[model samples]
Target: MTKAEETRTRIIQQAADLFNQQGYAGASMSDIMAATGLKKGGIYNHFASKDELAIAAFDFALEQVQKRYVRAVKGKRGSIARLKAIIYTFATAPDEVTVKGGCPLLNTAVESDDAHPVLRERAQRGMYQWRRMVHKVVQSGIDSGELQPTVNPDTVATILIATLEGSLMLTQLYGDRIHLQRAEQHLEQYVDSLQHVDNLKQQESSSR
Candidate 1:
């Protein structure tokens, strides 16, 4: 990439980290400039304003999440395994291990929904993508004969997305690990229900 493009990407990455840490309202253009060691005119040359930068930063963050987290479950067998892997990934994310900032989408959703519609639209798109990922997992389970025939992928996916986001919010606000753990517990239960009782024992034993 060109030197200017590389600098722009560095600016976006720094902005995303700050936005995830401080939310849309709290992280200013100056904060981004400070993080990237750029002056006001330099930042404005790449992004028109803080709002525009926020939208791009959020997109960059979500792109990372989709590549790292959502892609893990793609084309995997057994909906239960797919969902479990997803939860496992979130519970053991690279950034989560080193930093305290939780899900970027949730951070933006809570802060931007009523305040910044541009950012909110980006956040909402992210949430829909999240819900779609879960939906695909559930639907695959049914197609593969791992889940009950009557299960609704759309509904189940919606519940999982809402619960996951809410739990993460609480985990951040209360600074407690249990909220995230319990949310994963619920996800586990959902996965368990997808497995056939008759095949579960066989499924459990085959690898061992």
Candidate 2:
């Protein structure tokens, strides 16, 4: 990439990190400048205002999260496996990775819900994307005969997404990992319930 593009990307990366560490209101131009070693003018060359930067940084951070989830489930054959992979990654991934600053979607939702309209919209889009991903997986599971045909994709997706996010929030707030683990356990049970008995038996036996 060109030097200009590299500069823009660097700024975005730094901003994403800072925004994750510090909420939108808590992060500052000076903090970004210090973190990136870019002058105010140089930063302004890439982004106009803190609001713009916040929105971009939020989008950037959220995109990273989406990319991570997608990569985690990529090449996993069944939609149930894919869904399980996602929660497993989130539930059991090393503390160093998922612990810091909590989930980006949850962070943005909490911080920007009332104050920042643009960030709020971006957060909503991120949530919608996640719900849609879950919905797709549930629908595919039904189509592939992996799950019961009577399951409601949209409702199931919404609840799963909400429960995951809520669990993360509580875990982060309480400084306890058990919340995450419990969420994963319950979600796995829910997913297992959707499976046919033979498939479920095979999965359990395979785990043995």
Candidate 3:
């Protein structure tokens, strides 16, 4: 990457973490300056205004989350396994990626819902993408004869996403890991239960 591009990326990364840790209104120019170690002019040279920077930072955070989820499911052939992997990944995201802030989508969605149109739309898109991924896995399982044919992918995906996001919010608010762990366990069970009886039996026997 060019020097300017590299600088811009650095600013975005730092600002993303700051915004995720502190709401859009809470984070100030000084916070960005401290996080990026950039003067006001340097930061503005990359972003036209604070609003623009915040939008870019939020997008960056969302992209990081998407990439982590993708990596978690990589090389998993079975839809159940892939979906469970995603649940676990989200349930216990690494501190580096989480950046002491937890899920960026949830943070941004709740904080920006009423005030920031661009950020709210970005969070909405992130949620849609998540639902789509879950739906794809459920539909693929049905097509492969691995899951129950009667399962509704839309309903399953919606419930799974809602439950998981709600779990994250509770976990963050209460500073307890049990909520997250319980969500992960329940999600894993939900995914496993979606499998056909024969598949479940085979998996059970194989575990012996």
Best by lDDT: 3
Number of backbone-clashing residue pairs for each candidate, in the order shown: 0, 0, 0
Query: Which regions of candidate 1 fall more than 4 Å away from where they truly are?
Result: 94-100, 201-208
lDDT of 3 at 133: 95
Q: Can you tell me which runs of candidate 2 are displaced by over 4 Å?
A: 93-100, 197-208
lDDT of 3 by residue, 4-74 (tens): 99999999888988988998899999999999999999999999999999999888888888898888899
lDDT ranking, high to low? 3, 2, 1
lDDT preference between candidates 1 and 2, better one: 2
Q: Which residue runs of candidate 3 sit more than 4 Å off their true CA positions?
A: 94-99, 204-208
**RMSD versus native structure for model 3:** 1.7
lDDT digits (tens) for residues 25-136 of candidate 1:
8877678778999999998889888888888888988888778665677676677878888887775563353222668887877788667888888888888888888887
List the candidates' TM-scores in order: 0.88, 0.89, 0.93
- Which ten-residue region of model 1 has the weakest summed lDDT? 91-100
> What TM-score does candidate 2 get on C-alpha atoms?
0.89
**Roughly what TM-score does model 1 have, to 2 decimal places?**
0.88
lDDT accuracy of residue 14 in candidate 1: 85
